[model samples]
Structures are given as structure tokens and as C-alpha cells.
Target: MVEIRTERLLLRPASMDDVPAFHNILSDAAAMQFWSTPPHQDEAETRDWVAAMMAISPGGGEDFVIEQDGRVIGKLGLFQFPEIGFILHRDAWGRGYAREALTPVLDRAFSVHGLACVEADVDPRNAASLRLLHGAGFEETGRASRTWNIGGVWSDSVYLTLRNGQRDVG
Candidate 1:
């Protein structure tokens, strides 16, 4: 029941009610082009994914649906501890919603959850995601080659991190 409000968005925990919209977003090839897996083929796949996400206990993980004007437009969350990821409907891109949605989530991770730092792994070729991380004050921490076999393609990864106080981690 952790909910956060930004100037233009509401971030709330995902629920079964969000499955349809979640499926729509996840099934978009363009929107999911950089995802670890290909676009979900159908709603059943999304249903299973959302079911698992909704079943996570508090403190184990956090997944929030991004809402604009009461419509679900995307999702953002932590996976295990500090690893973070997000996805937005392609139509919502270039509108600064990702940054707007991520800032407060990072705040909660640092101030509310008391985490020392938050990290993200992005495919190096995903320029928009790399730019988003950098624009949000996360610094590049490392890089790796063929780190992930995403959708059968060997993908390099760029690791970025933001510590409490946005301090550089040595």
C-alpha cells in the first residue's frame, strides 16, 4: 500500500486490476525492444507476470504502476534489493515521465527504505535509458561484455548507481 505522488504522476503498487494495461504495455514491440525478454505474446503471459509481481511480500520487492490522469501508463520498481527497472508505454516516451516517476522512487529507496544505494543495468545500446539514468544523477559504475543474453542476442551492459545523497561511490 505504498503510494507516491509526483507533480504529474501517481505511483502505486500493482494489482490484478492493472493486468490489461500491463499486458498492453508489455506486448508493444517498440516499447519492449530493450527488455530482457521479447514482447509478451499475449495477455496470459502478462497475467502470469503480474501475478508473480503482485504476490511479492512487502520488503521483498516493490512494483508500482505509473498512473497519469488515472490511467496506467507504465511501471517502475526494484527487483531484489537495489536493482531497479522501469517500462513505459511507447506513447508516453519523450514526455519526461520516466524521470518524473523515478526520482521519488529513488527517494523512497534511500530515505524510506533506508537503502544505501540503488543500481540499474542497462543495455549499452539503449541510449534513451542510459541518458535517463545519467539525467537522474546516477553515475556510470561499470560495464560488461555479453553480460546478458537478451532475447537470444548477446548484449553488453552498462551499470549505473546512485547512492544516498547522490554521492559518487568509490
Candidate 2:
């Protein structure tokens, strides 16, 4: 099992046990506000999503659950090679958990996986996510208007990239 332990978090592969907590996070309106899809309606939706995630070969595609005090609190992972994404239960936000969870994952991406750079795309209006990425040493690469039609809303995207060893402050 691939697990990365930080001072306050455990980043581990997703499991069937996480579906309920995952569903809770995915279905929370405020938490899903910046996500590509709207809040999931039910557990079945989250179940299928979790099933797919679990099917991926371990460590072949990065998808980790953020656990704190033995409870699933969030997730951070590469959705596609080099493009990272993450989500936390609204209750878990603003406590530096994202940074704590992401820093080591970035290390693994660059050191273990040998990726030269990691990229991210965020809705330009999401100030919190922007700050998190920037605080993690990601530099803005570009921005495009109407780049994503998320939940029927045309959203602009801010692109950022972090080259290996570019910034170590996370």
C-alpha cells in the first residue's frame, strides 16, 4: 500500500470503506462549488465513482484519501498525468490540511514518479484554491476565458505549474 504520513494526515489509496465520507464531501454544495460537476445526488453515484477509482492499479494512477483521526476528510491526487486536483470536506478547510496533504504527494510525484512538472487548473474565482496552489510554489502559467463549462456555468481557468524542485516551501 502506498501511504504518505504527514504530521496531521494520512494520504492513502482510496478504499470501499471511504465511499460514505467521499459521498459526503462530493455532495456538499459549498465544497463542490468549484468542482467540475455539481454535488452528487446520492451514494450510488459516489459508489460508482469510488469503484472506478479503486480499480486503478495501485500507484499507477494517483488517487489518495486524506485521513485524519481515522476518518476520511478529503482527497488529493493526479486525475491525469501532471494535472493534480483535490477536494476537502468544507469542515476540513482552512486548517492547512490541503498543504499538509499535498506537499508530500508533490514530492512523490517528482521524486518517485520522476515527473518533471506538475500542473493544475482552477476556476479563477476560487481564491482559496489559488492561494493554496501559489502557497505550494506553483507559478501561474496561463489563463483562459470560458475554458470549462462546469455545471452549466462557463468558467474561466487559471493554469499553474510547479516544476520539480522549483519551490520547496510547502
Candidate 3:
């Protein structure tokens, strides 16, 4: 596992110690609105999720916890190679942490991991996430409706990708 550092953040492998803070993010309704699943009802759910993240084989995937000043604020990584996912505490929103954390992860994904490209599936209504992906040089590949039925509510998806050595197309 690799530990990455940025000007203001640390991207490290997840651990059982992260369960409490991760549960806080996973349990927040506002933060989970665009997530694949609904807000978790308890820490047990987050524990299971974190355990799964920890169990990812080094060659199979990458999962990193995002920390700021030593506090867990979010996470950004590829639990499955070529497909990246991330989340931040609501309190950490609009702070540029996600954007800052993205560059290095994508770099490693292409360089160290030898991936040809990285992809993202954003909920069509999640404007902020769309902007972040777009700004990070990801271009839209396609769109699909009724892609996810989270908690019985249908959500559409916008697919985007950034290839290795690719420059911003916008």
C-alpha cells in the first residue's frame, strides 16, 4: 500500500481505525444523496464497508483515505481499477480537498498502476461532482437514464473518462 501526500492532505490506505469517521460521512443524508446506496443507519454498516476496502488485494485495487491535518475528511481511490470513486464529509465540501486529492491519485493510476485510463460515473444531478471530473480533464463518454435505483429513487448517470497522457479537452 502507498501513502500519498499533498500540500494539505494525506492519501493513505484505510484501516479499522477509520470506521468512526467514515461512518460520520456515510451516515450524513446530504453527503449520501448521490452515492450508490442510501445513508447508512449505523456504524456497523460503515465497518463492513471499510473492512471491504481494507481487504482489497494490492494488485486488484486501490483504496485511500483522505486526511487533512491528520483528521479524516474524505476518501478518494479506485476500489476497482479504471473506475474511481470518492466522498467527503459535508463539512469538507467546497474546500478544494477533493480536487487537490484527485491529481495524484490519477497520476498513480496511470503511471504506477499502468492503467490506460480512469473512468467515473457521476449522477447526472450531481453538478459539483461533474464539475470536479470535468476540471480534472475527464471528458464525457456517454449518458444513461435510470441507471441506479438507490433506495427506490431512480438516478441517471453521466460517464466520463481520462486517458493516460491525456490533456484537458475543454
- Which candidate comes out best when scored by TM-score? 3
Which pairs of residues collide in model 2?
Answer: none
Error of 2 at 7 (Å): 0.7
Candidate 3, residue 7: Cα displacement in angstroms equals 0.3
Candidate 1: segments with Cα more than 4 A from true spot: 167-170
Q: How far is candidate 2 from the true structure (C-alpha RMSD, Å)?
A: 1.4
Residues 1-170, model 3: lDDT tens digits: 98999999999999999999999999999999999999999999999999999999988889799999999998999989989999999999998999988988888898899999999999988998999998988999999999999999999999999998784522
Clashing residue pairs, candidate 1? Answer: none
**For candidate 2, lDDT tens digit of each residue in 39-154?**
99999999998887777664556878999999899999875668899999989999999989888888878888898899999998899999999998999999999987867888
Ranking, lDDT, top scorer first:
3, 2, 1
Summarize candidate 1's per-residue lDDT along 117-163 as a digit string, tens digits: 88999988899998888887899999999887867888888999888
TM-score of each: 0.93, 0.94, 0.97
* Candidate 2 segments exceeding 4 Å error: 58-60
Clashing pairs in 3: none
What do the candidate models score in CA lDDT, each in turn? Answer: 0.86, 0.88, 0.92
Assess candidate 2 and give its lDDT.
0.88
